[model samples]
Target chain A: MTTASRATRNATSRPGGRSARVRDQVLEAVQAELADTGYDGLTIDGVAARSGVHRTTIYRRWKTVAGLLVDLLEAGVDDTWAPADTGSLEADLVALNREVREALSGDSSVTLAVIAASFRTPEAAEALTRFWDDRYERSAVVVERAITRGEVPGDTAAARVVMAATSPLYHQLVLRRSRMSRAEADQYARDSAAAAIAGLLRH
Target chain B: MTTASRATRNATSRPGGRSARVRDQVLEAVQAELADTGYDGLTIDGVAARSGVHRTTIYRRWKTVAGLLVDLLEAGVDDTWAPADTGSLEADLVALNREVREALSGDSSVTLAVIAASFRTPEAAEALTRFWDDRYERSAVVVERAITRGEVPGDTAAARVVMAATSPLYHQLVLRRSRMSRAEADQYARDSAAAAIAGLLRH
Candidate 1:
């Protein structure tokens, strides 16, 4: 197994492990701290005190605050919702947008904080990139399926379509300081997908 | 005049004033460094050396490296392009999208670095917000004009349309690891604008 895979196994395994419960508790504490204090405010001692885990155990598992946060973000990153095979690219995109909007609007304070932290640290950036890339990968599958079904042109760039469908959510989150509502996000997704499909057909 | 306004005046008034030339050289040096080295590689000392200005002069004007970058970004931020009076929202939006696409596709290295830097610094974020808001303000005029011409609903969310028009560029710049070409950008702008216009009209 790769180092990351081994780390994941170590994090989740509990059979005959004395530190299993401690790891779980520490992870939960990190999540709570992220929600309560954001990235900059998270601390190792705080996690230890909250989780009743020894500070040494926490340090042993994760070297820095950012490392702990990376673990938390990785643990909490949800699998992308299954893309609706709604027969129309527009409908599929709307469903995708709804899922994204829900996540963006949800109280995923820990996720947001970790995402913000990614900008400051290369380690965090790599972690966050993996997290985002996973989501993009899932969304790309949906667009690819649409193209295969002739909902969009065969030559349509799935990457471009996905980017068009989801870019507004990131823009609202990072630039506009606004939460993307479900209705608005769905509309954006549907319209953007429709437009991209139309362009693909035309070209 | 406000302090910033006064500073602007002082910086621009003299052909060879120490402050004026130093600020100009610093801004130019920052832009050049950004183009050549990206954001992570930028440094104030390097900029001072490149511009042949005293480090103290740069420090006096901008308190930190982030502050200096903010000023440079603000300097390059463009006001809204002319609104289309084409008697149709579709045409106006298309024109607006074209202008944005041109700006984004041209000299994108500087803009991309600024955007990446914004994620790292609050001052940079403020500057980015102002830059986007300026574009939004200009697009709002076009939307309002479209409403006046009975091409779009009077209550259409002009801000959202403006965002939709530009969001693809942001996605391509940060999420994708490729430079968006002008041709692709133009097609995206046209299709996105059409889609937004169609959605607006449907409502």
Candidate 2:
């Protein structure tokens, strides 16, 4: 969940208490440090200072930098995140791709940080794989809704379709390491939606 | 170019001299080390030890591990490798994607090694960007051939079409950090080809 939403929830449910708040601040600090200085600059002491959490508590709880990263990904997976439904496959896929584009854009993105971290750490790689798997499954709702609307074939491979819609954005941002105009990013979503409507994407 | 090709060229040309041979061996050692140990383990000492190219020579020439990586990427850009011509748009794309899949599939892929390196070092990232830009330009021959053969519409965006065809492979491997069956990998190529044919990928 976003920090704002998590804080609002904490306000509503005081019983979640100091433990939940501590996890939230610590993870937020980790994200900030990673975004500010990247994977190599990430350190347990940096996180402790930034989060105002004691070093002993952090070391006792998370143990290592990789441990903090895995917890961050796990928290994202456990959050109530889902794709926005727009009543049509094309619109829905566009919405999904837009989120992806926004997440990966700007200077020192947290998404890019964690992704780059996965390249360096085996535990981070495993956590990132699980994170993408959960994300793909959740995004499959777009295709399922499309099938229900009769916009796409019933046997359409949901995960593949989602991958098609979002991969171009990641391709430009991460693989190619470049930027694109927002219009160009949206075109990728359009292409995937059109391909699905043409029945080209199937199991 | 492959080492075999570079060796053959050096043999037939003979003008490359000892300097060229030194460069080739040093870069090859860098690739092997990065593949085996990844970015964090990459060091000038390891490269010098493996290459037998004197640490003094390495420091005088490449300077740092990042410098060595940048030179390796430049060599690839300078090579004469081109996509094959299978006549049809889909077949040509399949051939291209097949090459990409092969490059990234192996456990110690130089392709994956350098790609992952780009995340850790700024110089490597810049060189990788140039590498992809050069690659996309070269691969556009596939779209040019298709346009001439009446397969795809005129004014079809060559780079975008190429990116559409190949981005999914990078996505599955780098972004998602997962494996797919060969059949599944080919399906992404087919999707892009079908999209281009439908004029959905028009600029």
- TM-score of chain A considered alone, across all candidate predictions: 0.77, 0.91
Q: Residue-wise lDDT of candidate 2 within B106-203, one digit each (tens)?
A: 77777787787888888989988888888788899999898999998998888878887788888888767788667776787788888889887777
Instruction: Write model 1 residue lDDT over A1-203, tens digit each, in one string.
Output: 00111223445554546666666677778777777777777899999999898899888889899888677557534322346678778887887777656545544455556656765677777776666666677667777777787777777777667777788887776544566667878877776676666754244
Best by TM-score: 2
The stretch of ten residues in a row with the least summed lDDT in candidate 2 chain A is: A1-10
lDDT of each: 0.65, 0.79
Q: What TM-scores do the predictions have?
A: 0.69, 0.91
Q: Which stretches in model 1 have alpha-carbon errors above 4 Å?
A: A1-23, A76-95, A105-108, A140-161, A176-183, A193-203, B1-19, B35-44, B77-108, B139-162, B175-187, B193-203
What is candidate 2's lDDT per residue for A104-186, written digit by digit as tens?
Answer: 87777788888888888889888888888888888898999999889999888887788787888888887777887788877
Per-prediction DockQ, in order? 0.33, 0.78
